[model samples]
Each structure stands twice: as C-alpha cells, then as structure tokens.
Target: MFMRKSKFRHVFGQGLKRDQCYDNIRITKSSWDSRYCDVNPKYVAVITEAAGGGSFLVLPLSKVGRVERDCPLVAGHKAAVLDIAWCPHNDDVIASASEDCTIKIWQIPEGGLTKPLTEPVVDLVAHQRRVSCVKWHPTAHNVLLSAGSDNKIYIWNVGTGEVFTEIDLPDLPLSASFNFNGSKFACTCKDKKLRVYNSRSGECLQEGPGHAGAKPAQVAYLKDGLIFSTGFSRMSERQYALWDEKDLSKAKEMNELDNSNGVIFPLYDADVNMVYLCGKGDSQIRYFEVTDEEPYVHYLNTYQSKESGRGVGFMPKRGLNVNNCEIARIYKLHNSGLCEVIPFTVPRKSELFQDDLYPDTPSDTPALSAEEWFGGKDADPIMVSLKGGFVPTRKDALKVVRRSNVLDKMPTRTSQAQSTNSEAAAAPSLPPKPSTTSTPPDEHVGFDPQGILDDMRKLKLIVKAHERRIKTLEEKLSQYEVNTSEEDEGKA
Candidate 1:
C-alpha cells in the first residue's frame, strides 16, 4: 500500500493473471527455441512441447487480459515439435519442424482447428538429425529454411515439398535468420562462426569469426548490409559484435558485457533500428539502438522482472498498436503464466505525437495461398481493430505493472551502453536521446529521389562485378579438371 503508482508514468508493465495463461502449459526448452508467435495478430501460438512434444496451443487475445484456449491442439509430429512459424504470406497456415526429422505445414481452418488435426497438408523429411529451427523467408512465399544439429541448413519450397537447396556449414548451427528482403540470411553456428547466405543461389556469402568464445552465438541482420551477434568471450564473459556484411575480417564494434551463464538471444526491430538481446533464464531484456554509424549497438533500457523468463515471443511489427506509439511488444514465458511486455516511445501526451507517429501501418490481407506468394508479390496486412476500434488514448493505455509484489517487481531503468563513438558512455549504457534526430526525411517526409536512384545504380554494379568473379572461377576450375584428366591418361 505504500508504493505510489505515479512513478510508472509511461511503461505498460502489467503481468498476465492466472486465467490469462494457458492452463497446464509449459515450454519445451529455451536453449535455442524462442517459441511464441503473434503472426496472426489476433491469435498467438505457443508450443506445448513440455507435454512430451506432439502439439502446440494457439491463444487468441481479441479481448484484453483474456486468452481463448478452446482452439484445437495442432498434432502430427510423432516427436517433440521443436519449432513452428506462421507463414507471412498466409496468416492461417503454419510450418513446424520436429525431432522426428520431418517438417509439416498446417492450415488453420477458420475459427481455429476444431478437431485434433491429425495430418499436415505438406510434410517434408530430409534432415538426418533433429531439425532444431525453422524460419520463413521474409519476402518470399512458401520458402522456408530449416537448421539441424547435423551441421546442415536446408531451404525448401513448402508448396512442392521439394528442397530448394542446402548449405553445409563448418559447424553445427545454433540459429538462422533472413534479412528484410529475403535475398540473404545469417546464422550462428556452434563452431563460433557467423555464416551469411545468399538466399537466391544458396551460396555462402560471408563467414567470419563471430563471438569471441566457445559457446553458441546469436545473429541478426540490420539495415544497410550490417550484422550483429551476441556471444561469450574467450574468458567466458558475455560479448557482442557488429560487422559490415562486405568485410568479415574486421568488426565494426565489439564490447564485453557482464558475464552471465544464460545465452543472449538477439532480436532485431527493422522499423526502429534497434536490437533487443534476451538472455536464457533471465527476466529482463537488454535492448540496443543500431544506427548506420559507429558503436552501432547502443544499449537501451532493460525491462527487468522478478521471475526469470523461460522462453519469449515477439509480436510481429504490423500487429502492434501504433496509436500508442508502440515500437515492439514481447511475450515472456514463465513457469506459471505468460507476461506481455510492450516497450513504447511517445514524446509527451499530446495530439501532435499521435499525428506524427500514428500513421497507417500495413494491414492489407495477405495472399491466401503459397501459390500467390510464389508470384513474387507483396500485400499489406488488413488493418485489425482491437476492442472494436476503440483506440486507447495515451494515459488510458499505459498499464500498471501487476505482480504479487508490485513495488519490488517494478522495472529498474538504466543506461550502460556506449556512445556513437564506439566508447562506452560515462555511466549508463544508453540514455534517452532526442525523439527526433538528423535522420533524413523520407518521401513520405522529404526524400531525395535522385540520391536514392544513384545508390541503386551503385548496388547494381556491385552485383554485376560479383557475377563476373563467379564466372571466372568456374571457367578456371573446368580447365584444371581437363589438365588433370590428360595427366592421368599419360600415366596409365
């Protein structure tokens, strides 16, 4: 009764009640699997792998602080379902990979799966080891990638159930992710190498010594052909690094952090140019701002909690409430219930902030089928209305952090990141900067059309030069084969 509520002025720090959690729910493991989804926006998916691995539960949050659990259990994997992803092109359809060494794609018939959906529409089996992870291509339809402990990454076309290609890695892959355009991807491997792949040709675009230590690392792509990774140092301390995709030998920035045994999972927000690093078994999330300049990983604040998080889920960009100036929302899985954590950025409670930040987000209905996605087309997400279109105003929306002990569970904000010069800041990692910056205004604002066109031309030339190099290498290898054949005949 002594703690005052006025201090928590902006952050929405509410915890899910007992009923909000899926009854008798538990997660599989948090080592490399982040098993939570808001792909449907209206409904979120969480793996019930703790039930010994056959199914998952989809909970719809159409109503505030309430979850719909009547949805059917998606079952088919003979073994524990390790990972599942909602197709970006088709909201209802989902893809899952299992320890059974197979991948299955299921469609969420309207009103959710009513029966014990026994079979998936498409089943793919090729991985020799347990498929640990699966990721859908950001801009491509029906294109999916799977990573296995067998040290292989497979790209597949779910529609045809055919393997598009496979990339063999030097070590076992811990995780994999695609860039914004789906033309490239980055994966963190157990051997401590971060490998970037060309999605179009399945070529190893770049491989570099990633994290400084022997443990597994996490990698995420940033804007403008840059990548950032989180891992441990040689001395078993937590450290993260940023690198230019073009040059693997030199790093743009690398910093050692307080050593924690838990592995840090890197999640990137492309719209805001920020990356949130969540550690395994840790309650709070450490986020950083990624700019095109130096010291790219500028530490933001941490959303601390009393309960150590077991697993976490990130809501898709389009599913968020822009009217609240919401940047990103995270659902953390705890032993008892799921907590919805939303980190926002609003400058003062005024109509000006609303008009400036609350622009219409992409909500057009997506292609209904994988066939439509294969057409190489893009569509907006149909704008979803929450609470029957009654938008919550700024003060009305800021939720109070609810815990058994509200005062103790309140998040402690700090700044411990470095400045833009690659030097750690005097004290806090990241402090609040101006809401507006020197960033260029877009055409939606004041973009330079000529400058953009010039940049495209330069990129086109680079692609052509790369093609020429590949052709020359192929020709040289062919000639070498001819010479070796003649030498063998002479010897005979």
Candidate 2:
C-alpha cells in the first residue's frame, strides 16, 4: 500500500518546470579569454591572451561535437600581441601586431610546426615602437593598416607583405577605422585629434578636435559620413564627441561624462548608429545614438559579476539576424588570470526596429505562429494571455484620460467669453446661426439650450480661476516695484 501510494504521487504530482535555455545557460566568465572574435564565411577567429603577459593565441570558432576544436593559429611574438586583423576577403588568412614591434601575416593551413600557423608566411618589422592597432582595408582585400606607439601609421599590402604607404601622425595612435565603402579611413591618436585619410591616395582629407589629455581609446564611423571619438579628460572626466566628415575642424561634444571608476571602454555600433561607453567601477554598458543635434546616451543595464572585466566585442551587423542585438560577448581578466566571455542580450529591443503594429520583448524563444498565439494544439493561450494582460490597466487608462483632457480643455473663444461675465448672467453662447461656411444640414440645426448652459457655466469657472491667478501676480509685482522705489530714494 505504501509503494502504491508513492507510485500514485509520482504519477500525478507536479513540481518546478525545467529552466529555459535563455535563463539556464548564461554566458559566464570561462577559463578561456575571447577578447575579440571575428567571424568569416567559414570560421570565426578569436584573439586571446595565451598565458597572459603579452603572449597571444588564435582559435577557430567551431565544435567537433560538444567541445570546441581549437588550434593555435599563430605564435612567436616576443611581447604581448596588442591587436590582430583578418584578411577581409580570405577565410583562412589572418595578421597580428604585437608590442614586440612586429606585424606578421599567416595563412591558416601553412605547414612547419605541429600546430598550424606555428609559423608565419611573412614578417614585417618596421615600426620603431609597440604596435597598438591593426585594421584591414575596406575595398583592397589584402591591404591592412597598423598604428603603434611610434606615432606612425603604416598601410601594408599582404600580397607583397610590405609597407605600401607610411603616414605620420602627431601623437601615439590608439585606434583607427575604415568607412563602409572604403573611400576613406579615420584614426585617433594621443595628440587628441581625429584624422581622416583618403585610402587610395594616403592623403589627409580632414581632421577634428578630440580633447587632449589621455589619447582617445576608440574611434568609429557612423552613417552619413559622421564619426565618434571617446577618451578621458585631465579633470578625470570621460569624454565622447561626434564629427561630420565634410568639415572636421570642429566637433559636437556629446557631454562631459563623469568617469565612473577611471576606466572607459568605448565602442560604436554603426548598425544602429549607437556608440556604447562601457566599463569603470560600475559594470553597466551605456549606449548613445547618433543624431543631427547632440548624441543621446543612456545606461542600458548593469551586469552583476566580479569576474566580469572590461573586454567586450559587439557582434557586427552581419553576425546576427536581430535588431539592437546587444549580446556583445564580454570578458574580464580573472581566476587563473584568464579572460571569460559573457553573452548579454538586451532586455528590450529598440523602438526604431520594432514592428509598427506591436512592439514586444527581446525573447530568445522561437516566435509562435499566428495560430499558436490565437489557439494551437501544443500551445496554451492562457500563458500568453496572462503575459500580454500584464499591461497596467488602471495606470494606462488614467494616462490616456489625462492626455485627452489636455486637448479637450484648450481655451476656445466661446468658453473664454462666457468666463468673463458673472456666473448668474453669463449664458452659454448660442450655436452660431447657419452660416455660408457651415455644411448644409438635411434639416435645420436643432439647438439644445440646457446643454449649452451647462458648458457655459463650466467655462466661466475655469476663466475665473485663471483671472484670479493673473490678478495675484500683478499685485505681487506692484508691491515689488513700490519697495524698489523706496529703497532707491533712501539710498539717494
């Protein structure tokens, strides 16, 4: 009987439901450091610190079964690799720039050491100082750009593995970027200037002011040929500025940002014309959208993790098929002293990209069909019904009523005139006699004297209240004037 009772309980009892994938598998800081993952047609190559302290490792973004099949694609830099670039046109090609003052280009499947790219195809050692930035050409597939502490920018061609053109800058270059079409490129340097160049001719097309203090950490291009720059001020303020491509002599400063913890990781999302300022003492990512006026920025949300660090790479537009896709992979240097990746999906989708008919939450769940939303065999409409019905009925209704009252209560000539007369004498204005401007009625207009009288009474009360306020203000002003005169005479 005890066994039978247990069996019945097991068969009929209900408990907690299984956790959804979105909630259960949060991208936590792992042992691996994936600072930047660039996706190609066939593979995703991530740039990470191999054992910390200047060493770098590259891994392909593929899995054999459940575990990732990672092979060190490149090695041999004496110092920490500052940055890496992939050949925009070739899937198996990549390049790395390091603090060792060298830039190496490698083919993925090249032979030599046991691991692929345990060797490099060609090495370019031209920079006198540490290389900080590397980027591929917008249109020229094999061409790349590298900037370093030497305050120089080198344009290189991978085919020849040589410097194609060398350009000099005013200060130590921090970040650089290419425009959408490849016609122009821009760079931010320690000198506090953003310079735009003509990629084909290597000519300085334009340059703009970015406050000079600590050089800009990042620069990016926005739509309509606009640009953004982020850096720190001498006063310990974090600064962000926007510029127009045509005339770079001046820029519109977004706002004087208070540095949260003296560290700012600024990133620009061109797909949505948004620039994100991340990091500091707080673990929140702040977002700013570009506009003709001043750029508007707001804190998106905060991540609660001491393991989380400042290194985050936003997935470019080509990566995912959704709007305001903010699941930017973030990392921090921790634990065994390795980088960890945290994937964050924005809680709400931008209103700009939402459907005109109805906006919804950002859900990883596969969207249900119309039949499912209405009534389907597998779906329980009650769940959706309850979720959708969560809208605050009472508060929303009051808001609508308040807005309607604003337009409904605007002072009209008839109401204003009725308000001037005493309540007993003032009568509601008679409906205007049929005028030529009036639409001809099927029959003569019928007047409602009682309705008119009630409206006139209400109008008189409102106007009288306004008149009382005006009279009070005038009396105060007269008293102020009398006091001023007396004070002046006493002084004389």
Best by lDDT: 1
lDDT of 2 by residue, 45-119 (tens): 445445433433443333211222343335667766766666544445567777778786665542212363544
Q: How well is each residue in 228-323 modelled by candidate 1, as lDDT tens digits?
A: 888899999998899888887778999987778877878777655667777777878877777665555666567777878766677666666665
Each candidate's number of clashing pairs is: 14, 2
What's the lDDT for candidate 2?
0.50
- At residue 158, candidate 2 shows an lDDT of 45
For model 1, the run of ten residues with the poorest summed lDDT: 406-415
Residue 185 lDDT (model 1): 86
Query: TM-score of predicted model 1?
Result: 0.69
